[model samples]
Target: MLQSLQSVAFAEISLAGDLISANRGFYVLLQLAPDSVVDHVGPYINNPSFTELAAGAQRAMPGQVVYQGLITFLGELGEPRSLLARVCRQGDHLAMIAEHDVRENENLLAAVMDLNEELAEQQRALARANRQLAAEKAEQQRLLQELATAQAHLVQSAQLVSLGQLAAGVAHEINNPISFVRANVATLGGYVGDLLAIIDAYAAGEALLAQDPSLLARIHRLRERCDLDFVRGDAVAVVAESAAGIARVARIVSDLKNFARINESEWQVADLHACLESTLNVASHELRGSAEVVRQYGPLPALHCCPGQLNQVFMNLLLNAIQSLEGAGNGPGRIFLRTGRQDDQGWIEIEDNGRGIGPERLPRIFEPFYTTRAIGAGTGLGLSSAWGIINAHGGRIEVRTEVGKGSTFRIWLPLSRTTSE
Candidate 1:
């Protein structure tokens, strides 16, 4: 409401006679510029000095009239003008209202018109400043987003480096023992077969020595005590099972090495099916009791991509599917992996029968540090990193999800590397 009365010549002055603030009308009456610095009221008053006004205000109570009379004001051109003034005590300050005489009304009106034009120009300047500030703010936001993306990439690189080192170490440490044990199991199996043949030969000789019934009875008792028949059959089965177990361990280590791809950092034309298999094998422990995987693999050609990075993507998606199933209630959890080639692109789809994403959260699922999982359960960068890697490979990812049912993520990559890549 006070801002609406711009034409009123009102001023607030301190007890020490310093000019506090004034409206456009006051500046116009004094013939001063709109943004002029009027430090003291003493220099502007020609009739009564500000000292006399302060003394008068000190004698009156707050909200009481201090001085009511004509005051002579000195304009910028040193022209003295007399105007009717009323001063009131307002708390620690003095409020003054001044009005020009009837004969000087025309001059006051002209000055007011000039003040309005100056005010309009100032407003325009303020508006331009606001626009510039807004643009600068938007630029800052863009830079921050770029910084976040760069940080996420750095984190993913570090993780991959660590994984590669670990995989290399495990493969080296486990492969030697696996090879020795495998060979030992094969030799032991042959030794057991020869021992069983000797036992059978001894049994036949016992029949030949039937002339000594006591010797035959003693041999029968010894065989029964040792459970020779059961041992003969179980021994070969145990050795075979041990060899198979050793082979499975070797396969797992190989799969881990393949999934890590420590030595294959550069782009290559590789089998996508092999990559998927390696990833599945690497995450076998996590999927064992949680979710059953179903594969619907189609004929796909070798795709030009970073095998390690694609493996990382597959790992992330597979782990998320497994976790989702774990969180789903006591129903059977299933994950479907599908791959196919369409035109020049090959697509891999991972779908889960677990709790799905809601509408509000679907859009930001790939945003870094945005997660629906409980704190410490996830880093929230899995999907974001996957998205970044696919984009870097000149590929794209699509998501299809429904609440309470499940979610499907399909990654589409070009069969051949593009020139831009």
Candidate 2:
């Protein structure tokens, strides 16, 4: 067994610490000649406890002793190599030594540590990228919210401007009826004075009639001269007319109030014709001089919408139609306001027989700040804001026109409740 073990390429040493022989494998591992290895055996070994190992090996049974140590070859400055060695004593002549290489295991440990650090670096980079992307997304959302808020304010401003334009016409409409009511009241005041005088004359003369028969004739002459009967008949007519005038003024004011009250933003179910009527009345002053309005009101259902916003939209389109008729000389322009429902949709059409939109300008008319009207005469926000409102209400506006002939603006709204701003 000992000879076969040596043949398997283990090194051997004598009891005197001299290398007896070594196999080709040992010389190949150290890249040394067997003669050179034998010559330097004692000096080449780095272990200081080899003497103890040797003593232990001498007493130990064959193939029963093991030594774990590092070996440094002579004249080599490289790190010592780790080895697992086994010692076998044979017949008091020699001990056999065998070694296994463990240097690659150390190199593997260093490579693994480097790979762990590299992986940690990549993880940090990915985490930073994720943070940057999150910040950018948050900023984008904030800007979008600001933009939406600005658009809402712009639409509200346009509505207020449209109402300001109607103020003059509303005042005029109210003033006309008030003027007549005041005049009738003044006439009635004069009639009251004359009738009171006649009453005083009759009441005083009744006592005098017993004393003098001429007193009754004087009372009759006073009534005839004052024309009390005619005054009494006319006063009834004047009072009735004055009441009608007051009612007319009240109606105009009520309509104006209804139109103005549409500023609420919440959606509600409302009559489409009522909204149209209010809008028309508000724009009546603009229409009076520029065009004559003809209502072609059709059957329409109550629709769910923001009534105030819809009123704003209706006023905008109606005002635009009236303004388009500005130069229709010789006769008043005609504006046809129509409403109807078909299927699940309700529509309003404002058509005018006046100057129509040019084909080039028509496409851009709904663009913000785009207008064909003279500067200071229009803010150019009316139609654009109207478009935004209708869109937000789940509705749309359509237009048809021929240059110099006429133009029509039609708005179609869904009957169901719609989400809006």
Candidate 3:
């Protein structure tokens, strides 16, 4: 125990509160005592404070060991000296070891204290660096998550924007034909009523027929007003075209309602034939101006799918085919839409004779934001969304195209095992 204590920084204290003794290490370090041999006292060492302090210590302490730390004075080195001493302890016996050897112990102790201070500083610096690294890691994770979320939202927004522009353009083209047809129907209704009244007078009796030239005159007047000569060639063609036009308008409105239906609870298994027809009806206005549509239908099974969303897929495919044609330029432009079911596989192909995409562009056609169209023309989400929907239904899509030829998009839906669910 004593050696372990000695191995600590060398220190010695007197048995009481006065400067009876100090270690040589302490002596060289701070001159707590004037003489070098203080740790081991020589003969004739004397001081009343030491004696009194020892006596007081024994009295105060009773049977315990009496070492009390205190301040005392040592003789000064210079002439006309300043009295000097530092706080130290007094001991009981005045004389002990004979020599002062403190320089090495003092130097080692000072060096150890300095090293301790340096170690403490290093520990604090390491802790600060660890905290900073943790904070940076957390910040990086947060930014990565935000980036993923923002990118997903951007994809959805871009898709909706493209759909909006397509809807606006298609609606405009359809309205013009409907407006003319509606007006012609109202005019024909009036002309038919006049002809019916004139026929009633001619059949009334000879007297009524011969009453005056008024009936004949009235007939002539009606014919003049109705433009009989123009109607001779135009009326039949106009009425036939108008009937077809009104039906087209009604069909488009129905397709729009079915395609954009938000009331999902009303969903049911819809026949592919009906769905295809309605989709073509709604899209005809966009396609009519640029491409002729031909349908080749083989027997197909009804799909138990989200009607509105599946219609959206059709709309996307049909529009994409049309856009490809427009890019090619008008000429022998045609879109062939065919549907079939065979060997438990359902298939659809939308083929167009238009400017074809290159081999490099084809692979990325279904990727979001991939487009060959000019800016403001495409968001490139059409095929991607269609792809997603088809895949969700346990299906897949295939594309075939070559330069200056055209592209054919084929969609295949397999028989789902998960029964209508």
Candidate 4:
């Protein structure tokens, strides 16, 4: 059975979110016992390279994969395990992730990393196009960088540009190929190693169980002990995996195009609900099994705002909601989204009935990396980006959360549908 994974077949993995290991092959794979990964903690390894590489990968990959880097986990017993992980991110941040099969050859990893070069190329082309259309795009990118850090430019002159003062044409030329390559990254996001793992585990265990009759006898003994009369009815078990995959292609095309459009200028009107719906759809297959999302959107009007940027806002909020539930525990937690109107005020609220935030930490919810979640589990930009978008649209964002109850975010926007148009 494990022999099948070596050739070709896709499998799902739990190395990133819930457990250190997940293979469709059988419970034995989970029981084969991960040496280092913790049963409750999942795969969280202590390694700097893993984090940087995963971050770089997430920055590069667009549709299917979201790199979470190397994770270390302590097994059921005293053992440490490491795994490369990623999430599915069509916008910014990750929704789903997995650790892939490790390649023996380092060169293969380097070759695959070419996708980043492609993303860079896309940004480059977008920049050149921006230079021609909107004079402020360069500054916009720079300002975005500043938004993440303490870096800022006190400009006395009217001209706007990046802090690097980089050679724009050269950047463009280099980025062209990058954009070309990134377009295909989703195709490669398949967790081939994960798919191979279950079969691999079954085969690995079957082989070991073959060497000694005691192991087989022990299995039979445990089968009765655990009430596993027909446990191994089928010789092989396949992991259940669902990604946007082929259906995701169209959405990918739409996002890339929208990214290009939004990146071109800061002015555009978008349906806030539509953007949220798209982000939810893009992240749908990723969140289906692990968490359940409940949305309650009230009547909303078309917003004269940047759809791409708004999509980013929706992405951040939803991701934060998911992470909150994840951090709370693997139980039945609910995430709710509410939208409605209040005369001159219209709001979109995202509420999570998961782990709630404290009053002390509540003040800094929008601060960069200000998270209650474990270190690697969060970047803390989701709410902040949501804040930035809602603010830019002439809106207000506030959080109402309790330490144990849950967290709720209310984003107020001026209904420009009637005013702007």
Best by lDDT: 1
Query: Which candidate leads the pack in TM-score?
Result: 1
Candidate 1 ranges with C-alpha deviation above 4 Å: 1-143, 207-222, 419-421
lDDT of 1 by residue, 227-295 (tens): 988999899999999999998999998988787683356887789899999999889989888888999
Residue ranges of candidate 2 with Cα displaced over 4 Å: 1-230, 329-331
Q: Pairs clashing in candidate 2?
A: 262-308
Q: Point out the worst 10-residue segment of candidate 4 by lDDT.
A: 156-165
TM-score of 4: 0.41
32 Cα displacement, candidate 1 (Å): 43
* lDDT of each candidate versus the true structure: 0.83, 0.69, 0.60, 0.54
Q: Rank the candidates by lDDT, best first.
A: 1, 2, 3, 4
Local distance difference test, candidate 4: 0.54
* Model 1: lDDT to the true structure: 0.83
* lDDT (Cα) of model 3: 0.60
What is the model-wide C-alpha lDDT for candidate 2? 0.69
Per-residue error for 31 in candidate 4, Å, reads 88
Cα-based TM-score, every candidate = 0.68, 0.53, 0.51, 0.41
Where is model 3 poorest over a 10-residue stretch in terms of lDDT? 81-90
